[model samples]
Target: MKTFKSNVELVFNNLNSEKPSRNTIGILAIKERFETALPRSIPLNGYSLESHQKNEYSRWLKINTVATKFKNYKAVYISLKHPDRAPGDITAAEMRFVANIADHYSGGLVRTSHTQNLLLPLVHNSNLVSLWRELSSTNLSAANIDTMQDIICCPGFEFCSLANTTSIPIAHEIQNLFTDPDELQALGNIQIKISGCMNACGHHHIGHIGILGVDKKGEEWFQITLGGRADEKLQLGKRLGPAVDRASITSTVEVIIRHYLSERIDQQEHFLTTLDRIGIDSFKEAVYG
Candidate 1:
């Protein structure tokens, strides 16, 4: 068995190994040259900790160390957390610290954003201590399931020129509305996605609750769709009604969720399952009503 110092090296070694013979020097050099260059800490980006092998993981301390290295660069940072597995473990303080460190190191500021992640852009190396202290006092340094915002959303029409509506604004509004910790915890593994157009860039096709925008007579109309999927069970969302106006979108979705709550047998019943058992016709009636 052999191990490569960096993930890149490991990839090259694997490629070379496919030639019916092992590149022994390549393997040895991988051990020699790149090992030290391997990030001492995990990079905050997804790549640094993304699972390369089964049950294998990067060291948290090392990941933390690597994060400091980028304290002051002009970059955007994003992260994902599995909140269903834990609750409120990551704190605003930890987020604040990451932002502070990013600002200090880069001479920029940290911004805790709607999408669940930390930002430390425009930070510089010289201000790492102050950034660290600021973050420490704010309580923003947890990395477990507890202290995470496990939100998933889409670009919608803002980036895509074809968008019929704006997914970002709706996503932001929904995120703000659902600020209650108890509400989030009760939602329990729910995934909400929105698309500005029927193209489904927001992956609304797969969201437990999906929103799609459509054009009607030069006016923005949104379709409330249901029961679309992409995983092992692939399905497309069915339109619940003719497109409604922008102002009504959130209210319509709320009505649908309220319907689900009324019919759900227990807290464990997820959005999809509730939709499944109740049938879309029920949602259609409620939406149209």
Candidate 2:
């Protein structure tokens, strides 16, 4: 929305003169402003890893789908995060490899996301396991989509000329903190978007937890935001307090996460829900204190 002025308008289809809503936001403002499809921030309601249990295929089923919606189905996300590469960094061979997977499994259809992951919107559910195995062979099957490890970061000073500070390294540092899959899943659905500069390429502005890179006296600093969303109920995240030095940013994020874990009613209550229920002040105290 920053780069593009409102080119479209969205509203509920059933709304009428008798029963009307003037709120031109949230689901009504999806895309140009219609609620046809949901953004990544809004996943299937009541969806969680526990429901799928230990069955990898079952989990993938939730991420993907059987022949239904479109030509075949939809695969929510195929993580690009790997130990050997930065997030979304796909090599030539990997590109060809994913292309082949799409050709074979998705009717030659795929979609990339703002979060820097790929979605095969036409994969058959029956082929979920097969596709996952193929992607796993190349280390693309992290199954950590929308989890803490599924970080969305822009190419910072390392790549982008407009960047004030490096973003990939900080993303890596945060990723390293939660190397355990179980621990990440325990945290539940959350988003951590980082942008290298004010261009807002990485969408840190609306992340469940946002990290924005800045430069101060030639030193790198980061400001954080809480409770932002780009989903059906769109909201601009509030500034948590102030910027922190680069070295401490990752640890500060951990502190916020720990605070959410401690205060949540249960694992079922997501980070945002907990933050919403109690208030952002609670988190500000936990981090600033």
Best by lDDT: 2
As a whole number from 0 to 100, the lDDT of residue 189 in candidate 1 is 52
Candidate lDDT values, in order: 0.56, 0.78
lDDT (10s digit) by residue, model 1, range 43-151: 3333222344211122112222244444333233323333221111255654555544554354445555443455554443333334443443544432221111343
Name the lDDT value of residue 139 in candidate 1: 42
Candidate 1 achieves a global lDDT of: 0.56
Cα RMSD (angstroms) for every candidate in the order listed: 12.1, 9.7
For model 1, give the 10-residue run with minimal summed lDDT: 53-62
Off by over 4 Å in 2: 1-54, 63-72
lDDT of 2 by residue, 1-289 (tens): 9434433333334244344455534335565654434112222334343434447655545543334555434554778874446888888998888888887777677788767888877565446556666776887777677788788889999999999999998889888888776687788888999999999998999999999999999999999999998989899899999899988999999999999999999999988899999999999999988
The residue pairs that clash in candidate 2, if any, are 9-33, 10-33, 10-34
